[model samples]
Target: MAARRKANRILAAVLVPLTLLTLAGMAMLWPSGSKDGISLANPYSAAPGVTFDTGKIQSVVEESCMQGSTAPGQSPDTGGQPAPAGSDCMFAFTEPDQGGSPVKVVVNPEVAQSHGVKPGDQIRYLNLSNAPGAAASQGSPAYIFVDFVRTLPIVILALLYALVVIAVARWRGLRALLGLVGAYFVLAGFMLPGLVEGKPPLLLALVGSTVIMIGVLYFAHGFSARTSTALLGTMFGLAITALLAAWATDAANLAGVGSHDATTLINTSANISISGVILCGLIISGLGVLNDVTITQSSAVWELYELAPGTSARKLFTSAMRIGRDHIASTVYTIAFAYAGAALPILIIVMLYDRPLGDTLTSAELSEEVIRTLVGSIGLVLAIPVTTLIAVLVVKATGVRTAGQSAVGVPDEDRRPHGTSGAGAINADDVDDTGALAAAAFERRSRQSTEGSADPATTRRGRRADRG
Candidate 1:
């Protein structure tokens, strides 16, 4: 026990420093860009053409007309010629298409002249339509449209998430953080890269998810029976979710849903598969529920064991299952509400269409969300039973009892020697009998010993000793 404790201390000392160093490294290597920005390697690199229906023309116009103007500023001409006054002022029109016609954009003469544009000068269009081109474009437009606005939130959210996790869970949170980092690396560095390189998307997602589960559960909870049970439950749940997602996606015949963005990707990268991307989404979506269910089930089992050490495996399972039942009920609602919250606008639009309720519910887009929620909920529900069963078996098989054997029903009498009565078990007569017998025996032995003594001095010394 002492040795094990010493080893644990040593391991903790080593791990603490290593973990700090790793976090420091992550801080140093963290991306400094914004979240909404485009990337050079993004598959959606092609520019999309703008098409407007008459019904949506007003919205298009409103979107395009929102612009800000800058005041004119004077600068020295490149040719050392006298520049016109107010030539540096600029006006921006937001509408790409004006009045149902392809709009002709003209930079103001004063602004153009100040920027060295002659009459009939054609300004090159910097296409910020997709990620790759947007990434290539440098300066204020790129910063405003892509980096500062687009990508900043992702970075900030990531940092905040890390801090919140660490604050809430402490050491386990740190381990979970490491596991999350590992999962991201596996997904982005391995799974994504492999899929981009033409690997199967479904296979990629499955393997990546498995790797993530193993790393996360073991690292955060350690390689114990409880962790193993949770991992098993989570993996099973993930598999169920993946299978269901695949079937639902095929049945619904879901085409790529990203509007112009998806079209841009299709045009830019023939190697990229939309089907694979869809599968990846399914795997990612189910992971949180899987983790939640497994962890909850494992906790329930252990808590049951702590509460009743000598509890039979069956009783423990029953007790734990009560908790699992509650978890399932709440989690099902949670999954539904979460997806519903995200798709509320879509649902509202469908409702406004005044189609039959059945037809609206069966719509492809709505059905996709429904399938996701149901499949994930089913996976979570199944995970509870698997985790509970595993935990019960593990606790029972290990025969490890918590402190205080009293709770486990080990009686005090069984712990004591036979014929040894407790304080309350002894009577006054028994004590008096024992005392009198001991005194009589001692007195007889003393008289015999004194009579057998040959010398008067010895007898006298014995008597004096006895008196004393």
Candidate 2:
């Protein structure tokens, strides 16, 4: 019991100050929300006398490419070129959501050639019917396809995911989901804006991620020595990941080159550093996996100790690490495969280049993912043993008997042999603890009448009967 209190005090001393510092960092680095540096044009903003509207596809017709027809995302000044032999122009006849005549919407060439929409598909389009040039052209295009409406499908999947998680894990699962929402809130509210405002990327990521982990671990798992140990482990892993990412980003020259989005950000915002953004992304990407391994390892240690309280600390540590090893193996593959899946398109493109393996992996286009997998893997792998050790120490201090009595709360004599009596005799306190209750039950059975058991051999046989 004393040892448990000591551990709690130590954890409190460390975590409380860290939390305060993180809060201070967040306050200091909060974004001013000034849009002075962002010069990107908003394409979706409608012009005077024109509106963006949604519609259902009534039919699609193939025709020769028209020089004046506008395509989705195409600039108005540079119109479509003459149609190639195999690439005929396609247009969708859509019934607008607002009561009106069916409009002919020109589909973008990429979409028309790839996954063209059929009848009954809902899509958003630009309505240029009332624009200034509507009456000037011989046959002015009135509508242009924007993108598909995906709200219904996305919402359905989200609800189904929530139901399954809640049904399987109950209250804990619900808390986990809520914690996820809060984590995103922090990301969107604090970290993203801070980055845009040119805050120190490494510090912003570390502080923001730490704050997220603190909230997520405590809210989802509750306050306990076990949770505290896991949180500490998570912090260590996060720090390691940040440092590795910082070094890797610099050494590999990952300046977000060869990416269209990165180029766009560079062109639009002079304050935002593409490399810093990548650094932040590399660190943030590993948080989920890092937290998973730390918490799981911590829980594994506690459970192993509880199931066998008499096991030596060395044995306990060994057993817990066995579980950690399996986790490490599986989680490494998980990180690698997850990154691979997300970057599959890039992978296919790279493969077609027919470059050497070394050059291919080290290229700016692919090195970021390779480094991400390695850095995240290293951080999480190190955290497992650290979490296991902490959990083992804590569980030994609080969960098991120290000398002859319960370390949790019970008295010494309560654990004495079945028929013994002392100051620690079974009482209401015994009922409060599971281990104490089992001992008390055995004591009561021993005190019961010994009728029909005169022969010692016969009583021994009766005891062994259940073993068979």
- For candidate 1, report its TM-score: 0.57
Model 1: residues with Cα > 4 Å off, grouped in runs: 1-160, 257-260, 400-468
Taking the tens digit of each residue's C-alpha lDDT, what string does model 2 give over 345-462? 9999999999999999998789989999999999999999888887877777665455665555444553444454665555423243335544554554454434234577887786
lDDT of 1 by residue, 1-468 (tens): 332243345434544464455445434333333323233464324346422211111111111111211111322223555434543333322222223422223234444445432323223332233445544433212111111122456789988998998999989999988888898886776666655554666666776777777778889887555666677678778778788777777887755663454566565556667666766777778787789889889877776554434455666677678778888899898889999999897899899999998888778558767767877887788878987886776665555344544333443332222334476432222322323333433443454465666598886896699679
Cα displacement (angstroms), candidate 1, residue 169, comes to 1.4
TM-scores of all candidate predictions against the true structure: 0.57, 0.83
Candidate lDDT values, in order: 0.58, 0.82
Clashes of each: 12, 0
What overall lDDT, based on C-alpha atoms, would model 1 receive against the true structure? Answer: 0.58
